[model samples]
Target: MSIGMSFGLVFGLTLFDNIAMGLPLGMGIGIAIGASLDADAKNKGKTI
Candidate 1:
């Protein structure tokens, strides 16, 4: 959702720019967030 939103915003400003900037940025952020959630779930002994 973050990636999509970023892509949409950047694309609205300049077409294709989102692919270069937003994608990697959003993916990095998403990975970080996913990792944190995974860690938290593991701490609570829950499956994601």
Candidate 2:
């Protein structure tokens, strides 16, 4: 899920840059989820 979100955000940003012009919505949502996961992992004492 986190990975998916990251990919989605990347894809969205890329699309916005006209590099792909794909799904921005999915990208935004994915980024949010990924960020949350990253935070969680860091809090868990995991190397992010």
Candidate 3:
């Protein structure tokens, strides 16, 4: 999440010069990715 947010922040700052737009967007995308990874791990019985 942090990584995604930071990346998004940098991207937004560099391109759009916006922080509000980037932070939440990055967080949402990060959450989706985290969920997907968690589900995959659970399916394989690899989750702890």
Top model by TM-score, which number?
Answer: 3
lDDT of 3 by residue, 1-48 (tens): 887788778777887889888888788777888888899999999955
Residue 20 lDDT (model 1) = 62
- Stretches off by above 4 angstroms in model 1 are 1-18
Backbone collision tally, model 1: 0
RMSD of each: 4.2, 6.3, 1.3
- 10 residues in a row with least lDDT, candidate 1: 4-13
Residue-wise lDDT of candidate 1 within 4-48, one digit each (tens)? Answer: 556555654476544566566566666777788899999999988
**Cα TM-score per model:** 0.60, 0.53, 0.78
Clash tally for model 3: 0
Alpha-carbon runs more than 4 Å astray in model 2: 1-22
TM-score of 3: 0.78
Cα-based lDDT for every prediction: 0.66, 0.68, 0.82
Error of 1 at 39 (Å): 0.2
| Model 2 Cα lDDT, one tens digit per residue, 1-48 | 555555666776776754244455566676788889899999999998
